[model samples]
Target: MTTNQAVSVAVADRRPLPHLLVFPFPAQGHLLPLLHLSTHLATRFAFSITVIITPKNLPLIQPFLSSSSQIHPLVLPLPPSSSLPSGAEHIRTLPDGTPSAALIHALSSLRPSILRWAKSQSNPPSALISDFFLGWCVNLAADLQISHVSFFSVSALLAAILHPLFLSLPPPSSTPVSVSPSLPSFPFPHLPSVFRRYVAGNPDWDFTRESFLSNSLSSAAIFDTFDFFDSHYLSHLRSSSYASGRLFAVGPIPPAVPESDNSNIFPYLDSCPPNSVVYICFGSQFTTEPALAAAISAGLESSGVRFVWAVGTAAPEEFNGKGKVVKGWVPQRAVLEHVAVAAFVTHCGWNSVLEGLVAGVLLLAWPMEADQFVNAKLLVEDAGVAVRICEGGPGKVPEAAELGRLIGEAVEEGSWPALRLKAAEMARKAKEAVAEGGSSFLAMEEMVKLLKQATTED
Candidate 1:
């Protein structure tokens, strides 16, 4: 062959590697799953990855990305706003009583800077993957002529319940609507309460509504739930034309750290009996009220169970002797996997729920905000892997006796053997879904294929 012919052949074989830009909401629950997804894509498919995070949250996730050369972190500055305290870019850092309007404004201010950075990339990202709330990124991607995918850190069941198709239901005029009696087949019985609280009068209702609606227009929607756990909701989403046939279940994605690396993070686990200790945590964004925290502490003390509780801003002094009280960040995934951890007392945040399920630990659900109530219902009422501590609604706190009784019952050997068995089974399924040739693994493969195809077409 001539020199020109050889040069042409070389050029055809040297296709540029596709780069994906991931932007997660600046909260622990949202950031972890999207980070894991980015790591998985880079490790499994050799895709170039760029993760955009605010300056405040950079330190927390920087350690996780240090070893991965394939993934790069980009820091975006939060715009100047009097509404947010100085240096408080992350949702977790905002004051406990910060108005939702101010928080939403702070988040929305991120758009211009993100768009500017996207345009400045040396090799422009082939696609954009962002948290569902950052729906503006979808429009940004369209303008950049790249594909956009929305990542829902919540469960698929919650996504289905919040979809536009369901929100169109007529509201009751006088009384709060009881969806269970009207729609018996509905998967989430707790949604009516969520509707009454969030959709009706919450300050962030507009933001939530816009995010879910915008998600339908994305190239694909990704969920952090395994198929075995949410197959019914996934199937319903796929069959519905409103979902755009781009729904993908690619998770139950745990942190990407090695087992050995995480083992020593919590040394206290070694002293407790195997499957005897209860692990308690509310996700980063939720703060426990003083009264409720005291009640929970009293209950745990009375229950006679060994526990490690990670309460974000709640004073550790309150529960110093009753049980371990961890303030600030803890290695949650590491703690959950410890052999001594028998059950979880959680706020029912989807990430915590997924981690608990993956570890085969039974759950004592204490949902606090947003989709947590719906998630609690799914776990306790539908899946049988958890027991509800009390009726969940905004500002509803259980008595210490009730909390203690539930904790005691959840840990009793003879009280709910079937629930324990079911939890173990679900954990097995979660593991299977992410293994080679499993549903979640294949979903990742399919996503990479689609990304490559989009790049080729471009």
Candidate 2:
């Protein structure tokens, strides 16, 4: 038997075999989690895997593929891009971008081509795994007679939060928004208007309309998160979906643990002269108010701590200077792992939180949109590793003093030997959650079985 077969046989002795094709939502935030999950499955289950990246992400993914020679063989074909719309090109900041309607049309046009490519493969992927944002994958799988599974790349807690919101959406509203303005805001005050629209609009309907084609198709759903962080909510999804047996929790799909001395992952740790630097980053989807962004810069400068800031196009001029804003896609994983990063001033994205906790860094939580406020609550109130900042309004920005104080407090708290010890302990737990026989690893096994059954049974 081939080496791949040998590995598959060993893994499938307790279940069945599946070949997985993973397609992520076309953005960096969506792609990273799905790619991590793909990497994990290929290693643990010896599954034949194909990771589909838009031309834009080719560079980022290329490094990982090159870094590990073993993962090279499982790489399968990329779908032909010709049939997709010009607008479908995964360009950064596309001008005059089409709305969901046009995006849906473009995906529909590309569907037939994706199917033809699937058929052309030597061993067709047994199961198709894609981001819930792409909704068209459900129909494409139907056309190809393959099992399609939707994977949410956010935290299970976020998924659970969205799930109830999805269920509450009224049927076929004209604008997809049924909620009133007076609805109590989530405790996290800094949510942006764009994301507020997302929550206000029935995301369930959004999922159905944009991703699942109004729920006409039956596709299994999976989440990319671990039970340790969100066991209660994940358990709820599991119990609810037990009858359908269509949901799986397989996540915390970070890079594989190193042989020993994982300290290398946090390169900046040694450079710190005890609580010296503040790290700033907002989620990709969040828009930075130029005023607030400048105020934050002044705050950091005034506080007199070295800072590493990650900002996008919306960053103000004042923040762009010596030892301040790194601006434009800083190596987030690497920076968080740095020892100099005393505190994380973050938008409280789930991935960022996971990485910070892994690096034993304390947090200044600044959630903007969706369940981020809720996540901040869990961290600040439950975990005691972070502090939550209050917002001015729906789209209002905070003053420099507010941001500075939060950063200073986080750095101070993180510098305490006891707090650092606690962070280290949390880091250890995070590592265990992904190790062999850990919750995430076992969840992956269960998900693989579900995929294989879905593939073969059909």
**Best of the candidates, TM-score:** 1
lDDT of 1 by residue, 156-226 (tens): 76666666433575454543333323221332334533343344444465555565567777888899998
Can you tell me which runs of candidate 2 are displaced by over 4 Å? 1-18, 53-57, 64-88, 96-105, 170-219, 242-247, 256-271, 285-287, 313-322, 390-395, 413-425, 453-458
**lDDT values, one for every candidate:** 0.74, 0.60
- Which ten residues in a row are the worst by lDDT in model 1? 178-187
Please give the distance, in angstroms, between residue 315's alpha carbon in candidate 1 and its true position after superposition. Answer: 5.5
Clashes of each: 0, 6
Model 2, residue pairs in steric clash: 135-211, 266-337, 268-338, 268-339, 269-338, 269-339
Off by over 4 Å in 1: 1-15, 81-86, 96-105, 108-112, 165-208, 258-265, 313-322, 391-395
TM-scores, all models, native as reference: 0.85, 0.76
Error of 2 at 348 (Å): 1.3
Count steric clashes of candidate 1.
0
